[model samples]
Each structure stands twice: as C-alpha cells, then as structure tokens.
Target: MTERTPTPMDLLDFPGAAELIAAGGVEPPSAEAVDGAWAAVARAAREEERATMPATPPTQLTSRRVRRPRRLLVAAAAVAAIATGAVAYPVLDMGGEPAATASASEFFEGMAEVAEDAPATTPAYWKVRVETDNQDDGKRTDTNYFDREGRVWSVDADGTVHEPPAGEEGKVKKWPVGKKWLTWPQLEKLPTDEKTLAAHFPKDPNTRFDQVTIMLEDSPAGPELRAALFRILADTPGMKLVGDVRDSKGRAGVAVEITQKSWVRLGGGGGGGSEVTLHTRDRYVIAPDTGLLLETTHKTLGKNTTTPADRYTWLEVGPAERVE
Candidate 1:
C-alpha cells in the first residue's frame, strides 16, 4: 500500500512541526482554521502556476520583464508553509535601522525638496502598472493607461486589453485606486502645506496615514505634488524612517514606516465602550536621490505573527504608444 503524505497536523503528531507552530504563535491554530489555511495554500499554489503560464505575447512596444521583489518571495514562501498547516514568518531585516531610528521629518522633507525642483511634463497617456499579492488573493498584475483627454486602456492579468464599455466612450474601468482616489489634476491641486494637507485628509491619524500612503503609492502626482505629499508624510505622527534598504528590484532607497494604534469602542453605542487597541504598520520605500516612491507594504500586527495585509509595487508610469 502507498503511504499518504503527512498533513501539517499529521507532522505535528510526530514531533518538531508542532513545536514550530507553537513557536510561531502563543496559541496553536484550531483544526478547522488549519484545514482552511491549507486549502488556501493549495489554491494559491495552483494560481501561481497558472500565473506562470505563457500569455499572449506582449505588443512589440511592450515588454514583459518583471523584476519581482525579494519580499514577494518571502510572502510566497510563507504561503508554501501554510500548505502544510504551518505559517512561519521569519524576521525580515532588509539590513537597515529599525523604524524608530530614522527621522521621518527629515527624510520626507528631503524627498519634498528634491521633488519640488524635478521636471514635469504632461504625457499623451500615463500608464500605471502594478503587481499585488495578498494572503487570500494570491497574486495578480494589471496595467492602466489614461490620457488627459479621457481615453483609457486596461491590460488585465491574462494579457487581455479591455476598453471602454458601450456608451462609456470616455470612461473605462476605474483603476483599483484605494481610499483616497484622486486623478492627476486633482492630485496636482492638493495643498502642499503639511497642516492644510492634514485638514484635507481624515482627522483620524490612522485613516489619514492610510490615505496619504495610498495617494503617494498609486497616484501619478506631479513633481510639486510629490514633494508636498512627502512633506505631509513627514509631519504625520508615528511616521519615521526605517533606514536605507534595497527593494526587490535592487533599487536602493530609504524605508519609512508609520506604526499606529487606535482605541476602538468595543461595545454597542449605548453600552460603556471598552477600549481595544488596533495596530497597523505602513511602510514606504523611496528612492534616495529623486524621492520617488518605490514600494508600499502594509501589515497588521498580531499576537503571533505580522499579517501580510497588502503590497503594492509600481512597474511603470510613462507615455503609452499606439493609443486608439
């Protein structure tokens, strides 16, 4: 009779695996959670293989060279461990100072100063490309090209080019821009002063930080706005530099992270609310010379492990060719 491969729990019964899982967290995962996590792992692996399948060849003007980052590999490995019912996350030291050591104000202030003087041009079309990976969603890629005159082109993961729907000539599918969705012009019009910028975003520090991060991460802000955005980040509470490090693409830059905890009322409105602290960390990788954003990653702190919330890495932003 053929022997079946051991599941994470099966391995735990033998030895070593249980200890590792125990070390990963104070409380071991329930059996149901482990099984569900393993299923996710299986699905993720299959999806990854499908993602690697050859697609319709890139256009002559387009290139398919993707510089997947080191952190992405780390996330993938984490998923791999989950297949066996163990999710082990090692300490990630990209060889730099902790978030506490660097100056949040000075770093963004530096980015602001450089960005203020950088050149700006209105391209015929701006293409935004990004790769996103989530603990549940696996990995997906997309490209969005938009022109000043309301033309849009979207390239999906399968290399399918989607255009505007019927009667939606001027409007294509909206970019998957997060919370603070601002177009190029609106972004340019944003207030540069830190105090005014704060007023524009949410009053809640955590929400404001996330909004600012989304703006910086996804928007094709002009040089002036870019500088202003960095300055705004500098002034945010809990924002600090995490020291210089290289991105997955080997682009070296300083990393900054904002760690925030918010007290939430646990009970119903009428009930005396118990305060629960919600923790979130947002990190940004910025090019030292130009102050350009390289990458942004979000994680939620947990008792046992830091949850891999979301990661956004820009692939390109430039003039598109062969516009219809």
Candidate 2:
C-alpha cells in the first residue's frame, strides 16, 4: 500500500515513537537485541510496519537475522515489491537450529543477479540433471530435456531413455502458481516487473510457497523470470536463512529453510484420544552466484528431535540445445 520499500525510518512511525524520542523515553537497544531487533525490523517491515519491543517477531511469524545491506537489485519495481505488507504468517516447525542469519532479499538478489550479469537467454530446451533420494527407496538420478510444448527426453544413469507419452506432442506441462497454472511458455511470458509479476500469483502464501519451489526446480525460466521468482519468495513470509552451506556435491551455495505444521488424529484404544503436531521443514541450497538450486533436504522435527525425510540434490542444471 505504501508503494515504497520500507526502511529503517519506518521504525519511527510507531505510535509513541516520536513522543518517546522527544521525551528521551526510549531505551537504546543492547548488542544482543540489536541483532534480534534488526531481524524484528525486517519481519515487521513485512507484517505490521510497526516496531515491537523485546525484539520478538509476531507469534505467527518465524524469522532469522539477515546481514545488512540487502541492496535493491531490480530498482524499477523493487520499491513496490518490498512494500507488500501484511503477508500472512506461515506455518512451520523448527528445532534448536542455528539462528538464521542471511537476508532472504539479499540471498535472492545474489542468485537473481549472472551470466553477463544475468543476460537473457531463450534456449531450445530446459535441461535438468537431478537426483532424488527417497527414505524408503535409494537414490536415482536422471537428466531430462524439456521442450516448450511439454515433451521431455530423459536419460537414466544406465543409458535407458524415457520420453513423453506418444499422443501428447504439443501439450505442455502446467505448473501450479497458486490456484491457477502456467505452461512453460506462459511462465516465460510472465511480466518482468516485480509488481506485475507478483500479481500473477495467488494470495495463498502456502500455495505460493510450494509452487514457487516446483517451478524453480523444474522450469526453464529466463533470467528475468528467475529473478522474479526469487523476489516472490523473498517477499513471502516463512523463509529462514540457514546461512551458507555446500551441497552434497561439494558446490558452494546459500541455504534457507521453510517449515510446515500439521496435525493428525490418533485412532483406536489408548492413543485414539490424542493428536500430534507434525512439523516438517524443507531446506533449500542454491548457488546464488551461478543461480542454480543445488540441493533440497526435507526434515521432520519432533519433540527436541530432528528426523530426515526426502532429499533432492541437483547433479546438473542449465539450458539445453535439443531434447536429445
């Protein structure tokens, strides 16, 4: 609503802030609170545009401190984009994990920002070499080349080939954005401007969260769209910076986590009268410098315990010339 990127100055807009400043009534934040307050400010910037004492995020919000100087990458619409206030609080679970320290905006900006400062490209096919490791099953890696019309040519590790169904030649695979969906070409056609680009997504934050992950992992989005995708996630609440980490492949990347909470009812006998909370976290490791998603680790956090779930490590991802 403000149509401007919120800044430190916004803190002064707190109802009694001016009075406190005039009366010298406000207490200076100590060292520990500053980091927490800096994080509190970023969260407040997205939620209420008001400051909170004790430097705690709203109960519904779970945030981590990001380092300073998250500059504006896409200056044109970034102002409007960052000002999207009152985004819904997200559902997630966490353990005594490390205090999140990277800024979502900065992390995305780095990735959104390289290939000639991220020059545009229109490759014939979107290529991805990914490994999916299931907890039940083992690991399987495949290199897939996808055309604009939704056809895929996948080659397995042992040299077997997998192609799309015979009858579906020109039909494209549509990825869900929110309630709606978009084909690969439509994804490319999405407006580059952040405000307009953001309008294309649904208001449901969880829907926005999952769909964004899917598209980024699989779609052949261009530089601009790729940048916009990061921007969307940056603005979306619930991302906790896990700081920098190396993927399983030993490639350097920045990692972040998002948690989702659910509950299941027990059935029959002694446990039948009870319910339990299931808190699952999805952690993503992406090479911001090269703008490639390297790995994703899903974990289930229980009473002071963390259990591993599914994991996906991107072996290779880039543009392709053909679906061969």
Candidate 3:
C-alpha cells in the first residue's frame, strides 16, 4: 500500500489560513479582527499539539490535525469582526443613543465669536417676545417687559397691562423674567472654560436643562458667554443632536436634545408601593446660520404614555422697551 500525503486543502483547513487571506486583502483587516484570528489559531494549535504529539516526532506538524468545523468557526469570527457592519455596529448605540457625528462644538465656537462682537450697551431693561404652550393652558403669547429696577409687567393682545398684586411684588416675578434663569450680572460672570461652565450647571436634570436652554434663548449672557453656554451644552452628558427642525417661528435651525431617567415613587403600599423610572426628554432648536437659539421643548414619557410638558419660544429682539 502506498502512503498518502496530506493535500494543500488539508493544510489550509487549519486555523491560520484565514489570517493569510485577510492580510492579502485589498484593505487591511482591523487590529481586533487580526488579534482574534491569531488567538483562535494559537488555541487550535495547542489543542492539536497536545492531542497528537509523539514522544519523538518526524516533524512538529507531522501528526497534528485540525477539524474542518473548528477552522470555519474561527475564520467566520475573524471575518465578522473585520466586516464593516458586524462588530462595529454597536458603536452607533453608545450612551443608549446614536453618537453625534457632526458635533455642536464648531457651531457654539462660532456663536461665541458673534457674541463677543455684539454691542454691550446696557439697557435699562431687556425685553424678549415670549410664547408658552401646554396641553391644559393652550397657547398664549406675551411681550415680557421688565427693567433692572425689579419691576415686572406683561402685555397681552388687547394691549392690556398686567402687574403682580402689590403685596406679591418681589425682587423678580416668576412668570417670565424670573424664569429666564440667569441675570445680567450672573451671565456676565459665567465661566467660559468648557469644564467649568459644565460644572456650573445644576445637578437636577430639570433645572440643569432649563438653565441651559434659557441661557441660549433668553439669558443675558451676552455673545461671548452665550457662545460659551452653547459649548457647555454641547458637551453635556446624554445630550445628542436631533437634527434639523424649524422653530415655532418657522425659522430653520439645528436641534439637540438630552434625555434623563429618574425614579418616581407611586403611592400604594405603606411606604410607596413601587418606584418606576421615568424618561424626560428635552430638545433645543438653534439657527444653524446665525447660531441663535430658537426654541426649547420638553416631553415626559412613561411606560405607556407621552406628555408634552412644556414648550417655550423666544424671539430675541434686544433692549427691553416699555409696552405701547
């Protein structure tokens, strides 16, 4: 009987063959894929060597063998890891959301420049056109008129003047101006350093979100500080761009939003029957060309329901003026 020699297919059926093919490809295989393939080859080599090594062998691989299935398995794994959509697909879901490709960093950086060049004429007051909407309250628009002297006032469509009850008069009224979140002096002192500005944001998700949005649409942070504020928001954790959107005023702009999950207690048991996490999403719209903040909207989503909690629109016509 004639002894048979193993064919090339038998040799290539071992673990290392895929690595050679990948190396010779038009494009180089990824480091991760290469490493994984080599690891598989080493493991198979060790197992084959252990199973068939002779006390004195004619050659190191003279009696070694690799199963067809094992070779195919390792080759498939390496290919999967190296393929465009296989192992790299999970990167899209980082932070439980799609990663931002075109970051807002440049937009904010440019806005900061425009802000720095803005005239710093201190007005006796600052006025903004304000509109708010909710499911229960419907929609209402008002001209928020106020002065640094702490007097607050609002004008309705009929050109009616509304004032706080004399006794309710405080340093700042809560309806509009007070909700602006940052005063002129405070905005002036806002840190431009990215990390510092991010740190200055409140820990509470609602407040942190409100403060940031207000800074964009309504805060007296001026141009430089406003630009810094936009950068801070861009760097905020969990914040992601929601792409293009039109503000309530129908101006085209870019929208970015952040979602936070929190546990809320429901009354049922002696203490509280159970707690469920609620997801709150907030979105902000900014003009892409001019970098002006246009709108901010918030939604609260529960297991089976979504609520449009708050929406605000700000048209930044600077310099507060007395109501006509």
Candidate 4:
C-alpha cells in the first residue's frame, strides 16, 4: 500500500486553502476582507480539527501529534477575538440603568449641594493636572486652570501661572492650548453612550477634537483631566456597568469594565492592520452634592500582544461652569 502526503491545500481544508490563495494574490486583500477571510479559515480549521481528532485515541496525544489542532485552535481564538471586540481587561458598562447609576446620580447631586453651600458671591476656579503614558514613551504631565469668566490658563507643576495666549489688549484668547483645553462643559459635551461616543471620538480622527476648559476642583481633578478621561471612555467600547463604590480617597463613585476586541491600524500612515484584545476598567466619582464629575481612573490591558495597559487619574469637581 502507498501512502499519499497531504498537499498544502489539502492540509488546510477548503477555507484555509482559499485564504492562502487570496493572500498570495497579485494585490493585497482589503483589510476588511482579509479579516473576514481569516476568520472564516480559522473557523473551518477548528471544525476540521475537531472532526478528525479521535475522542479517545488508543494512545495519548503528544504535542507533535496535536500540533496542527493546537495551532488551529490558537489561530481561531485570535481571529474570533478580533471579529468580536475582546479586551485584555474588563470594561464597565456605561449603558442601561444599574445600581451604580443611582449612586452616580446621587454623587452628582451631592456635588451640587456642596456648591450651593459655598458662598455664591465668591468666584470659583478649577485647577487641573494631566499625566499621560504612551507605553514605552514614559510619562508627561501638564497642569491648567479654569476660572469663573469662561477662561482657561496653564499652570506649571510648581503652580506657576502661564496665561493663555492673549490679544493686544492682554485679553486671553478662547482657543485651546496647542488646540487642547479642559472644562466642565467640554467634558459634558462628550457622549457617554457607547454608539455615539465611539463615532465621535475615534482612535484615529481625520480632524482634531476641540478642547475646552471648565473649573471643578482646586485639586488635580480639573477640566483638562476630565476631558482626557472622556476621550478615553469614548474610545473604548463594550464597557459593562458595574456599581457605585468607594475608592481609596473615600470618594463614592461608579465603576465600569469592558472587554473589547478591535482592529488597530498599524504604522504612522494608517495603511497597515493589526488586531488586539483589550480589557479596560474605569471609575467615575461625582460630587456627592452637585452632580458634577469629580474624578476618574482608567486602566487598560491587551493580550497576546506587546501592547501594555494604561492607568491614570483625573480630578476636580465644582459648580457647573462653561468655558468658551
């Protein structure tokens, strides 16, 4: 009897063979199409592997004997992860009514209460600090302030005041610094719902987002920090609503987690493709009296890739004031 070795196409089943042919075509496949085709091949491979493998082999299956199936399983999992947004960490749900929703609302109301208790005749200002970490790029910090007159100013780490760009008359211009500003109204303008948020704050936007400033707290939780948090929350989808909880700061807040899978474009030109799974957790603290946002913390995780999770905190909450 003569044994016939499997051809490349035969070794892959119909879908896998088709994928190989398509990938090696005269032109590269469209990223969307390539992703779809890869998923199909992975599913087919999984089914075939399962069908061919005996439930109870006469002998134990060694790594060598099970290599093909194992490889197929891994590939299938990866494809599936991309097809569905799979995040490395859990994301809190921002949608639907949860126990935390009531708590969140209560916290906001509380902030309002605190504001009402303060002297209405006295002007209020919000001081903000922002810290960003881009994986290997280390960390950078920026601080700013929002005053009662719908104006924003930059503050150095040591509390040195740097006025926003001013006109010939020394009036501060309203534009964001380097096109970025932070304020309560600006943060409120951002969508919290999943669908609209994703559309508005895409990871890669063709146009830059407008930045504004609003004052909330005298501490680190400022308008700039809130704006950044809103951006991060908007970019991440599939967050599940957890509930209201207390943080180390003894603040009452709402917590949410999301496990998302998404296709991240590679290269600076936005011409390449890569898929990753991310898990993110975020918590929002509202003024227990005023219904204003007080602070936030965000954490993210990515699996089977070099991408690292990010963590940061935002603070400041006060009377609801708008920044132009």
Candidate 5:
C-alpha cells in the first residue's frame, strides 16, 4: 500500500488511529465536535504589504518559512465531548512569541481578523483547483468553476474541459450541507452574524464542525461569512494546534487537528479476544502568509504508520478561465 510520510508536525496523530478508519470502523475527527481556518492565506502576502506600511500589525510572523516555533498547546478533547460545556484548549499563536500555553480564542480570533481583511474579488467565476493524494488512487488534480447562475464546470487532469449547462448544477455539484444541497444563491444567503450562523447550524458541535468544513470547501462563501465561521470554530472546545508545517506541495502553513475513536469487540470461535480501539485524525494546514487552506489531511495511524487516508492540497482558488 502507498504510504504518506510523517513530518515533525504530526503531534495529534495518535498510533491507534489507523486501525478504526482503515477497517472502516471509525466515523470521523477536527471534523468532529472540537477542532480547527482558511482566510489569512491572502493576508500573509497582504500582511507583508501591510507590515511595510507599519500601520497594521501582522498576526502571523514573517519567519514561519525559516523555522517553526514549539508545538505550543494540546487540547485534551474527547471524541465524544459534549456541547454544553467548553473544553479547555491550549492555543498556538503564529504571529508572536512562542510559549507552552496561550488562549485558543485569541489565536483563532487572529484568523478572524485576517479573514475579514483578505483581499476581495468579484470574479466571473469562482474557481478552485485541488489535488487529491489518495492511498489507492495515487494522485490526480481537478479544476472546478462555479458561475454566477450557480452552474458548475470541470476540467479533468488529462485536460478534458467539461462545460456546465447554462443554468444547471455543475458536473460534481456544490455545497453539500447537512441533508440539504445548497445552490450558490442559497449559500450566499447563509447567515453571516455569529449568533445567527451558530443557531442555523445543528446544536451538536460535531455536526456543526463538519458543516462548516463543507461550506468553506465547496461554497462560494464571502469574506465576511468566512470570518464569522472562523470565530465559531474558535468557540468550539478542545482544539489542538499541530504547529508549523507545509502541505504536500511544500507550501508553508500551520496545522490543527482533532481525533475520533472507535471501539470494536474481537473474538475467535468460542473464545473472546480483547476489545480493540482505533482512531482517525482530521487535520487542516493553513498558510500563515496567504491565510488559505493549503491542505486537509485525514488519517488513521498504526503503531508505526503515518500514511493518510485522504489528502487534499489546494493548488488554486480564484477566477476560472473563460473559454470562447
């Protein structure tokens, strides 16, 4: 089997993770109740520009590329943590001094600032190109475009351009949220304020975390909406900071993770073996400079394994090409 390499940043990647997910026993993680940011990628470059002017202070430092600070804090969150109480989280701040501890609320709030300050665009089509590094499929990069009318256009790795119908869903689809698949307009109408956005989601933090991932990845959510979502993620309890790292493409970023566990009973004919538990870790790496999601990694770890179950490295997300 093809294996993913382990970097120094795999702090939350527990050894028991792979047994459950690899065996199809575990459900999910950070994708779980307590976890994880996307904006700020735009701000990295913008932050540099702003730094030259000396009016605004950059939340992420200028040296994430040279060396990574300590793996500051770990969240003691359980896979089945409840929604009523907040789990204490040790936050990692990318902008300033390194420490053994900090406030997670403040860390993600920095992300919220960058999300709001990111450069704006009103492109003809919202385009995204992502490369999926799957254990079985090897590797393939695909391009997608979403038009103003909510149509989807796609291009395969072999350069096959698949055009969308004038006003139909794209070949792949858009915004898969909860039981409802939302069109572009409906997505635009999503609540942007913190309270309303939180209330609009399921009260279950686990479900809410996954739904936010869906919106950030597939929907054409604006900067303000993205900012609010960042704040909401900050409010989620027991989030771990995985420290500075790079995506498969070798882009600089910070990783955050949450874990999920599954337990199964093992038995032989007329004999009972001990129950075994497995884990799945969901991790996101965000570029501190650009404030974009550089990668999303999901994996189950064996005693000495580090290969990821699913890996997505976002190569591009901007305006799609216009074909005559």
Candidate 6:
C-alpha cells in the first residue's frame, strides 16, 4: 500500500486563512505553510523515484527560514514611499521673489521734522519781491510789504511807496508808522485773526475787483488771504523741527524743512484755490533768539493751469528794516 504525504495545510494552522474561507473568500496559505508544502512534495517525489531506480544515497533536504524582522523591514520600506509622496506635495504660489519692506510712519515722521524747521514768522514789515520770467512775456517784478499791525504797502520800481484808500488805511491805523527792525516776539503780540489779516490784503480771485491794483488795496478782510499767506506755513503738513543753529546774520536760529501738499489763492477775483506741492530741501533758518524767520529757499510745483514750477528765494531779512 502507498502512503500519502501530508499537505502544507496539515503542517500548521493559520487563523486568517480559515476566517477568509468561512467568509466565502479565497485566501492563500501562510508563507511558512507554502514552504513546508513544497518541501513535502519534493521528498515524496524523491522517494517515488528512488524506488524505481538502482540503490542511491538519499538527497538531504535544506530549509531556509525567513525571519519575521525581514518581513517587517519590507513592509516599512513600502510605507516610507507613501509618506514621502504626501510630504512633497506643492501648494505655494510664490513668484520666486522676496517681498519688499516698508515703514510709512517712520517716513512721515522724518518729513515732519523737516517741515517743522522751515523758517516762518510774522515780520513787522516784509520787503518781498516776486519776479517772473515767462517765455511769452518780459520779466517783471512786484515788491510789497506788510507792517506789524497788518498794514499792507508796496514800493514801485521808482522807489515810491503807494498807500491804499482812506477807508482801507483805517483798518491798519495802529500799524508801525516808520521802518523798524521788528522782532518775532513783537509781531506775535499783534492780532493774527483771519479777518484782520484779510483786511490788509487783496480779496481772493473769486471776489470783485477791476485791476490787480484795486485788489492790492488791502481791505475787505477774507479768510482766504490768511490761509494763503501765513496759516498755510503754520499748519503745513509733513513739516518737522530739525535743530537749532546760528544764522548768517549772527542770530540764533532753528532749522526746519517741509515736503507736503498745500493750497494758495492767486489773482484777485475771490477765485478758487490753487494746489501747491513743495519739496523744501534746504534748511530754513529761523532766529531762535527772537522767534523770527530769517531765510529759506524752497522749490515748488503747482498743479494750477495758470501756475508753473518755481523757486522761492527768501532774502534781505536781516539788513532790511521792518515798517509796522
């Protein structure tokens, strides 16, 4: 009688395989079972062949055991591949450039410091001249003055002082009569009310006036004039105080600068305001000892259709005498 060799399933029981079979699923035998089955089949075949052949030495069977650690190592390698894919996903939309940095507050603070140092004050009498050189017209000069009591006067090219009408003159009755060196402290004591200032200057362009001379009558007080002349400087944006120093006239002074936008009225019709932007690079020399404006130079740009680029050269402050 021939003896049947045991199958791999009979050598070891595998719980997972039995459960899968009960669930109506086809499951392969465990690795160890497959290895044993192959070995048993080989031995049985060898015995059958030996019986039919001449006597020969029985062949030794060798088994190689696969460790559980080696199987785990293979599984870990597969999991690493999946984890690497998850980590390498790209989602950033960077244009491959670094971002720019900026500080608006710091920049504005620096500008304020410069503006505060700008030379400004109410002079007892300001001997100012406005010179213009236009391609379509010949060069012209306009010389004017303002007294301590807010009186306005002008000197013609022939060196003649022209006075306003009696009605307007009464507005500046308390103004200084003769030329004198008026300090800032003295000017500050005078009224700076907008109505009082306008009374001594021309009405705005929108207002009524025939010739530029009539507008120069220095009467009919208006708020626009004060804004154009003094308030604009006092409330200038981006103006800042820099430091103190002595001016060319040997007066202790404060330095200031301004780079900001402002408005001013021109002509005499009570006209609308014109926009002005100034970038004052030079330091304004203000007499610190007397709180008077000494000298300054500023570059200005006008957006008004009637105006153009220009530079204001403030000079003759020290030697010139004030008349209020």
TM-score of each: 0.58, 0.64, 0.60, 0.36, 0.61, 0.26
Cα TM-score of candidate 3: 0.60
Q: How close is candidate 4 to the true structure, as a TM-score?
A: 0.36
Worst 10 residues of 3 by lDDT: 84-93
lDDT of each: 0.61, 0.64, 0.59, 0.42, 0.61, 0.37
After superposition, the stretches of candidate 5 with alpha carbons farther than 4 Å from their true spots are 1-103, 165-172, 262-277, 302-307, 321-324
If the candidates were sorted by their lDDT against the true structure, best first, what order would they fall in? 2, 5, 1, 3, 4, 6
lDDT of 1: 0.61
Root-mean-square deviation per candidate = 17.5, 13.1, 19.5, 21.7, 15.9, 38.5
Positional deviation of 50 in candidate 5, in angstroms?
A: 20
What is the C-alpha lDDT profile of model 2 across 1-324, one tens digit per residue? 668867765635544444444554344443333333334444544443232224664784532222233323222122222232212222322233322333554456455543225656778887888888876777888788777877778787776777776884534567886567777887877786666877777766656678878878877777767777877776666677776799878889888888887787877776676787888889999876777788988888888764457889988777778655
The digit string of per-residue lDDT tens for model 6 on 1-324 reads 998886755432433434433445334444333323333333334345445554544464322111111222232322332322221211112143221111111222223333334444433454556553444444566666655454557678888877644565443422220233233234343344434533433332112111111212222212233222333233223333455566544657666554434445655566655644443233455543333345554445445444432322233322135432
lDDT measured at residue 55 in model 2 versus the true structure, 0 to 100: 62
Ten-residue region with minimum lDDT total, candidate 4: 205-214
Which candidate, 4 or 6, has the higher lDDT? 4
Best by TM-score: 2
What is the per-residue lDDT of model 1 for residues 126-174, given as tens digits with 9 covering 90 to 100? Answer: 7778877878777777788776644567887677877755564557322
lDDT digits (tens) for residues 259-291 of candidate 3: 777787898877758887888887888776556
lDDT of 3 at 222: 61
Candidate 5 lDDT over residue span 1-324, tens digit each: 988875644543644334423545333433212432212222233444444554434675441222222221212123212122223443445344232123344446566667776665666787788888888888888788778676677887777778786534335355655567777667778887876878777765667677876666545677777778877777765456667787788888887776766576788655677777877778888776555677888898668667767998888866545732
lDDT of 5 at 184: 68
